[model samples]
Target: MKKIEVFVEKANDGTYWGSTQNLPGGVSSYGNSFDELKQNLKAAFKDYLEVGRKLNENWVQEIEQLTEFEYQLDIASFFKLLPIKISAIAEKTGINPSLMRQYASGKANVSEKRAREIEKAIHELGEDLLSVSF
Candidate 1:
């Protein structure tokens, strides 16, 4: 199986857009936040894997090569490590609950703006928690 590493970046419009560096012209959803982007990427990756499986082609190796020497981070796990709930994040960011849910479940696309909001909320919550602990 060849692996394909996907890279996501935020656009000026506050959308999280992603493309597989291993697969040229392979771009996925443009979400309103980072969480949405992660969700969209999950869906896109699943589809890509399924299609590859159906064709008896494995791109896992390719992806590994593409991502080699690059810092790899699991966005979902990072979200899970947050001290706050998705609901809180949504409330703080004014993002739709449904959208946050989708991102959590890997079923929806998150925009760059949303991602920033989530990050900000998580950071703030972490700081607050630290202050309490001290």
Candidate 2:
């Protein structure tokens, strides 16, 4: 099965929007929440791929094999789904608690570099946890 990466973000209007990175042009979809967004995105992908296959029948196998999709959530939405406290994560990531809260609340934007740093810290913590034999 082929994997397509989808990036999801929460819009200011309190709606979730998503788009695929590998697909050509600018195809997008929107919904009220993450679960809704997933359903809508799948429908959008089907519609988008159908248009392409209509022009070229060679894309049949590709469309059929395209069963897996991976979603990357934006910082605010990620924090919304995360079960940890901002203060706890701030300590783990070495980020300021207030700043982390602001980012989590969508009151402040987290830069790509800072977001990477935070994610890296979380991954490293996961690796450490995995190393515990007990």
Candidate 3:
């Protein structure tokens, strides 16, 4: 059960694009939305695997056996894909709302420390939501 990490980005035309980070020749795809992008990326990769299989590429065959994909995207890409409000998340994470907005828009670089803070806050929020009975 191998997972290929797909790096995703939001294009200028509001399209989402993604590519495998560990695959050669760059298995990639684009879509109007995130779900569509993931679907297309897998379909494209399967086709590529079939072609590779015919060529007897051992590496491709190994990956083809059970290669799953997981998307890794930046903050800007997350905002583009989800309805999450930046200011709200920022307040919960103790980040300045304006600074968080800049991060979400790719206008600012988030340090590793800040990234971890945001990730931790999101996970905690998810857990809190999961505990709701109503």
Model 1, span 24-132: residue lDDT tens:
4463665776677667776776676567667767654454244222212234435543344778877876878778777865577667776777778767877877888
Model 2 CA deviation exceeding 4 Å by range: 57-64, 81-83, 106-111, 122-134
Single out the weakest 10-residue window by summed lDDT for candidate 3.
61-70
Q: After best superposition, candidate 3 residue 57: deviation in angstroms?
A: 0.2
- After the best TM-score superposition of candidate 2, give how far the Cα of residue 113 lies from its true spot, in angstroms: 3.5
Order of models, best TM-score first: 3, 2, 1
Provide C-alpha RMSD values for all models, in order: 11.7, 3.7, 1.8
Q: Which candidate should be chosen as best, given TM-score against the real structure? A: 3
Regions of model 1 farther than 4 Å from truth: 1-75, 80-84
The CA lDDT at 3 in model 1 is 51
Report lDDT per candidate: 0.61, 0.80, 0.86
Whole-model alpha-carbon lDDT for candidate 1: 0.61
The reply for model 3, stretches above 4 Å from the true place, is 131-134
